[model samples]
Target: EPEVTQTPSHQVTQMGQEVILRCVPISNHLYFYWYRQILGQKVEFLVSFYNNEISEKSEIFDDQFSVERPDGSNFTLKIRSTKLEDSAMYFCASHNARGGTGELFFGEGSRLTVL
Candidate 1:
């Protein structure tokens, strides 16, 4: 079955440095999302994209954070300036247009560590 895939499964960066995480979502899915989990914290929603535009975003998705579907297949999240608090596992997820039950298929995630 098709699945979401992410790169740089683990990364360690200094605070204030730029970081970009990449993902390739399922081919047929129409909606895409980015979520993050801070160590032992609950999962938090960052943003959602559909039809090439941001459909919704949470406050956690500040100006420093941005998402793009640069080509037809890759979805990416860029943190213009990483912070110590930004250390977490960032997940890329997607779902089909049907939207039944709002199930999301998620990638294993790219772990970001800032010091």
Candidate 2:
């Protein structure tokens, strides 16, 4: 079976520093997304990417946040400046198609900690 993979499973950074989380989604999947969970809170959608462009984005995905498929195999999320509130578990997700049973494959998540 295939699954999404994330790098730097855990990261600790100072406030105002840049952070980049990396992921490798399933090769066959067509849609990619980035989500986050602030400790003890509901999962929040950040952004969705497809056909090499952003499909949709939440307000939480402000100018500080960006997502990219730099190559055919890797997807990445970058935060230009980290804040105390930015600490959370960032997840990478994917689905092969859009109109199915709404099943999504998710990565283990990269935990970000800002001091």
Candidate 3:
């Protein structure tokens, strides 16, 4: 069985530094997304990418954030300037199709810590 994979399971950074989170989704999946959970907060949808462009994004994905599928096999999310509020567990997910009954495969998540 295939699954989403993320790198650098935990990262510690200073406030205002840049961070890049990477993900490799299931090979057959087409839709990819980034979500985040801040400590004890609920999970929040950040952005969804498909066909090499953003299909949907939440307000959280603002000027400081960007996402890209750099290659056929890898997807990445970048935060230009991290803030204390940016500390969280970032998850990567994928599905064969959007808004379908098909389940999504989620990565273990990359935890970002900003000091």
Candidate 4:
């Protein structure tokens, strides 16, 4: 089965550097989302995108964050400036349709660590 994939399974960065977390979503999915889990916290939705524009974004997706489908197969999230609070497991997910209560397929995650 096709699956989502993320790069650099772990990332170590300073407190205020830019980081681009990369993801390759499932080839045929229409909806893509970014979610983060702060260590032991529940997974929180950050943003969702479809048709090349943002469909919805949570308050957690502040000015420092942006997302794009750089090409047919690549989706990326860029943090303009990272903070210690931004350190979390960023998971990329995709669904074939948004209307149904289908389960999302997630990548193992790109773990971000900021010091």
What ranges in model 3 sit over 4 Å off?
Answer: 98-100
lDDT at position 86, candidate 2: 98
Model 2 residue 114 CA deviation in Å: 0.3
Q: Which 10-residue window in model 2 sums to the lowest lDDT?
A: 95-104
What C-alpha lDDT do the candidate models reach, one value each?
A: 0.96, 0.96, 0.95, 0.95
Model 4 lDDT tens row, 1-115: 8899999799999989999999999888899999999999999999999999999999999999999998978999999999999999999999888566767999989999999
Better of 2 and 4 by TM-score: 2
Q: Give the backbone clash total of model 2.
A: 0
Model 2 RMSD in Å is 1.2
Q: Candidate 1 clash total? A: 0
TM-scores for all predictions:
0.96, 0.96, 0.95, 0.95
Model 1: CA > 4 A from native:
99-102
Compute the lDDT of residue 114 as modeled in candidate 4.
Answer: 98
Error of 1 at 55 (Å): 0.6
Give the C-alpha miss distance for residue 69 in model 3, angstroms: 0.7
Once all C-alphas are superposed, what RMSD does model 3 give against the true structure?
A: 1.6
Residue range 1-115, candidate 2, lDDT tens digits: 9999999899999999999999999988999999999999999999999999999999999999999999988999999999999999999999988577658999999999999
Quantify how close model 1 is to the true structure by its C-alpha RMSD in Å: 1.1
- Model 1 residue 46 lDDT? 99
